[model samples]
Target chain A: MNMTFFQKFFLFFSLAIVCAGCGTDETMESQSSLDINPLSAKPSLFDQSPSNMAKESLMEYEEITGIKAVNSDKEMIIAVQIKHMKRFFMAKHRKAWQKEMEKQFPGWKVELSTDRKIYLELDKLEEKINKDTLSKDELKKEMKHIIKLSKEQT
Target chain B: MIFFWAFVVGGIICVIGQLMFDVFKLSPAHTLTILVVFGAILDGLGLYEPLIDFAGAGATVPITSFGNALVHGALQEADKHGIIGVVTGMFEVTSAGISAAIIFGVIGSLLFKPKG
Candidate 1:
């Protein structure tokens, strides 16, 4: 019944390993499923896009500034964030991205910011979406508002 | 073929984990969180998918695989809910494992006692 720290640790570690392996068998299936090409429905190692343009734009942004975009939705929202220090330089690209998105969304816009709080709201908003309390358009609007607030947060 | 690769890959990932626990002095909780977070980052970057493809279960069964599941869930949510999917997708991937852990862990604590 008596145990040392290592004994407790060993017991817990073994349990973790055993439990880790014991979970549902979907991990491999899930990963392999991504191997399916949207273009072909057949398996493929190439063409995971609709992200191609976003990737290109982000590359251009990084190439000139030597800073990478930390993240981007790039499609629905064109939501993106640069490193905190680099956010000051985001104005031109933000404007450009907004102009580009206008073709599809008209009054819709894009933004660039380094705000940390929007992420917290994003978490809550995500929950609301899951619960079905918010309409789809409302979620989109909330996201855009958050992204804009992120850009304006300085 | 898949099972062999799964064992090898899964073993190597677990070995790295064990080493971190032994040599680097990372607690099991912190190590587990780190692995999952690291995997999620890789998944977000579009890198982990290929690694998963190569390693199969070797890549997918470990803690990092949980991170991939998080990304997968989030991506699916994004499709359904728009931008917030990025936030909402956190735990859906590993929900099953988590549920099992909680249930079994509580039972073990009730039945087993550690003497100090």
Candidate 2:
């Protein structure tokens, strides 16, 4: 029952692939120090806000580095930057967060995404809102645009 | 770090191919065919997408990913249009790669002659 070198090597490689499939990815450490504070702890954008609650809840997860959220009367949109490695399981994380958020705020539509483009758009929206540069109608239109972008397949 | 992982994963894949050729006395064609089929199987099992997510271009750059793409396109279209979709969608994602291979193969043949 002597195995050739090729057979031995093949067996080892198969074991390795199986072990790799079994292993779960660990969440990576924060890369940058930007906005290390929780969004709820940040300077008040609005009091008793559902958007703030959404951001705060998102920040509790270590993989979420930065979060931007804005809500209309019926819809709450959230964008988060996940740690690079954890992005491998991003679909899973997003689904879990979506369920939790929907549960927390019943009757409110919770839209969560980890797309880089969405994050950048939300960041711009946050800046405009902070500066009070956007009118109510303008904010509503922008949110609608972002939601449309999220729904895009490509 | 991302680059590092990409190199490591891509290199490992190449190494495995090399081993199959050198140790098992497999021809290059046989080795490549086996790898591509292996990739398609992985994709069928819903495993290759996670690998691509984890390794980025490291996973996508290999020949294995070509098979994964072919199966993925077929499966996606099959869900929408049934049996006909499998044939129609087989090349949706892989048409670019196949076209490039043909064009490059012509260029390569024009540039060099095989002695054997």
Which portions of model 2 show Cα errors greater than 4 Å? A1-48, B99-116
Fold similarity of candidate 2's chain A to the true chain A, as a TM-score: 0.71
Residue B45 miss distance in model 1 (angstroms): 1.8
Across residues A21-123, which tens digit of lDDT does each residue of candidate 2 receive?
A: 4442322333543342233322323322778877777778878778888876778888887776786788788889989899988998888997778988988
Clashing pairs in 1: none
- What is the DockQ for all candidates, taken in turn? 0.03, 0.19
Query: What CAPRI-style quality would you assign to candidate 1?
Result: incorrect
Q: lDDT of model 2 at residue A145?
A: 95
Lowest-lDDT window of 10 residues in candidate 2 chain A? A36-45
| Angstrom error at residue A130, model 1 | 46
